[model samples]
Target: MSDYDVIVLGGGPGGYIAAERLGHAGRKVLLVEADALGGTCLNVGCIPTKALLNAAKTYEHAKHGSNLGIHTSDISVDWTELQKWKAQTVTTLVKGVGFAEKKAGVTVVKGYGTFDGPGRVTVRFDADGASGSGPAQRAESYTGDHVILATGSVPVMPPIPGAKDNPHVVDSTGMLAVDAIPPRLAVIGGGVIGLEFASLFATLGSEVTVVEMLPEIVPFMDAELAPMLRKALGNVAFKLSCTVTAIDGGSVKYTTADGSAEAVEADVVLMAVGRRPAVQGWGAESSGLEVSGKGVAVDDRMRTNLPNVWAIGDVTGRSLLAHAAYRMGEVAAANILDPEAHRRGEVMRWGTIPWAVYSIPEAAGIGLTEAQARAKGGNVQTVTVPGAMSGRFVAENGVKAPGAAKLVYDGDTLQVLGLHVVGSYASEMVWGASVVLETELTITDLRQVVFPHPTVSELIREAAWAAKA
Candidate 1:
């Protein structure tokens, strides 16, 4: 039996970050992880997907450089090399996580941890970490003054007929490491995951189709910006308000919004509906942890109903994004270290959390949409600026590309309530927008902030000026 100041279960963004913070704060910490250190984001999810997408983008640029007067011949994609690069990137980042943990003086235990009691856990060592050259591994009991759960989430594999039996049907994880790019790909969801994969394959010469159940893709995105993003995703077909009925081998059958049955023939079908929190297993019930269908119930401070217990990141289902988990971990560590400040209302800010989709013409937004602001029933106003309005935007991506910035404001106060952008560097620009929203910077205040001349970010400032007009 061992005891520690803090014991963190799961090594995803949330758990690892919380452990690092606590360890750095001079608390004895134990981090238990059964898999790689960086978890899904650095392993199969965000990191690998972005690496492939970046390669696809480079390939597209090389093949279509005629517009920029940079001609190239024999441009090609080598899948083997692409996979190797992604693997190397994942390896480096995972090692980096371990190094950070070591630097923070966190003792890492490789195992599956289950709650044995309020402040206790039973860890069944991973196969590689087992001892004594025996088939039966070792299980150890440990106690902590405080425990944090950050188990993360898994992709939702909905029960559609023939989906499980069909080899062509693959979830996000499976789709990431496919044998080769299918000539025709049928994506079963139109959210960020599906749309990103669609962009990646479409750029790599796959005939792609995205079928979404909702009226629009990316349900959280601004209604006005969603269509613009869809338009920006060139050569990808989108079928909105559609429901998947079944998978017939390589074909996907679904119902259209008009009450008609339809099927898309493809060499592969990607089941990318979404992810659900991994609330089951690892002893939530035994520990009396309150968990809803959504996820482990937690307040803004990442506190659970149980004393000295906390949950963060996707496990809380507050936000599924990696960046969101990072912030949650910070808040949780702070609260744990300074219970006095935590009791004084140090809570996580749900608003001002930015989101981005890293497609070819990336899309990102922070704060409320126009409709959301209007629904709040106060004086609301919005202004739009085309991406071409910025000289830098025109110099890089021609005027023909789909690009725009929309600013939603509180009319009475002239305070910028929301900022959304669709076009190049949209992802990079949204963080600054989040800062403006976080600090409650009004349009007038934003006007005085000198933006570097000739940048895509200037488009947001332009939209701010237009709001006053």
Candidate 2:
């Protein structure tokens, strides 16, 4: 039995990052994984999907290249080549993550790790591969002083009738791997993932129909941004306040808000409902851990009920975002190494976290919305500007597209409370607002910072200046 100071299970973004941090802090660390190191975000979820989306975007540009005075003929999408490129990109990045782990002196163990006790883990693996052929082919067990659970979440497959049996139905993972674009794709959820895929498929000539259970698509975002996104996805159809009842071979039966059942013909049904934390099959029960339907409960320090056994990332159910998981991992590693470092209690401020939906006209925001601030009983003021004012937007995507920016301020203190943007490269611009919010910068403080002319970032500064005025 090998022993280490820290043993991280599930070497995804959270676990691997924690292990690297712990190892760098002069603690002996071992990071174990059943699959790749970068987890879902790098391997299957975020990176590859974005690559595919970029390809679709390029395809769309090429298809309409003639309108832009770029004469192009016989523009075609090579599916096999696109898949190969996406796979290569994923491979390169995943290898880089593994290389970083090794450079950080983290012992990477490949297998399924089960918690044997509070600080003990037994890693089991099949003896068929390279690690199995030699003397290292057998299952192994290791004990550590501190254990971190970073097992990520998987896409949730809804329990709709006939949803599972149909071959036309595909989850986010399968949808990303699809070699051929469907002629007509029906997306079940109107959240980030669904809308992203809808944008991709619609731009690629797929008759896309997004059926959202909520009243609006991207329901978690500001309702004001929804209209802009809806206008951007003019090609795609939306059935709001709808519930999917059943999905047969090529038809989806759904109930409208009016309680009428209707079936839509679909060559492909993409399920983008959401993802649930992957907490099962890791011997969480043996550790006397309490897991709600969402995920394992953790305090601000990421500590579970059991001492020395903590959870982070999607497993904690706080925020399933990769960056959120990375932050939690850093906190967990710091708290584990030196308990007194962050004992003053840290706030999981969701407002400061930048949220992005990678639709065609991307929507992103940092800090509180106008409605959220007003609900908090603050005298809130807001300012909005059209995207056409930004020369960058006009230069890159042209002035024809519509975009807007909203800035919210505390009326009493004149502090910048929130920044919302819905337009071209809105996701990119939100990072600037994130910095302002993280620093707790007032509207006056933001106004002091000079922004270069003809840039989208200027919109953020302009919005802040307007709010202050």
All models, RMSD in angstroms:
2.0, 2.5
Candidate 1 residue-wise lDDT, 1-469, digit = tens:
4499999988999899999999999999999987789878989899999999899989988988999999999888888899998999899999999999999999998877887656798888645783223452778999999899989999999999999968999999999889898899999999899999999999999999999999998998999999999988868999999999989899888899999999999999999999999987789877789999889999988899999899999988888999999989888999989987566656788998999999998999989998899899899999999999999999988887889999999888988899999999999899999889888999899988999998999998899888863
- For each candidate in the order shown, give its overall lDDT on alpha carbons: 0.90, 0.84
State, as a TM-score between 0 and 1, how close model 2 is to the true structure. 0.95
Q: What is candidate 1's CA lDDT for residue 164?
A: 95
Give the range of the ten consecutive residues with the poorest summed lDDT in model 2. Answer: 128-137
Please tell me which predicted candidate would have the highest lDDT against the true structure: 1
Error of 2 at 24 (Å): 2.0
TM-score of 1: 0.97
lDDT of 2 at 364: 88
Residue pairs with backbone atoms closer than 3 Å in model 1 (clashes): none
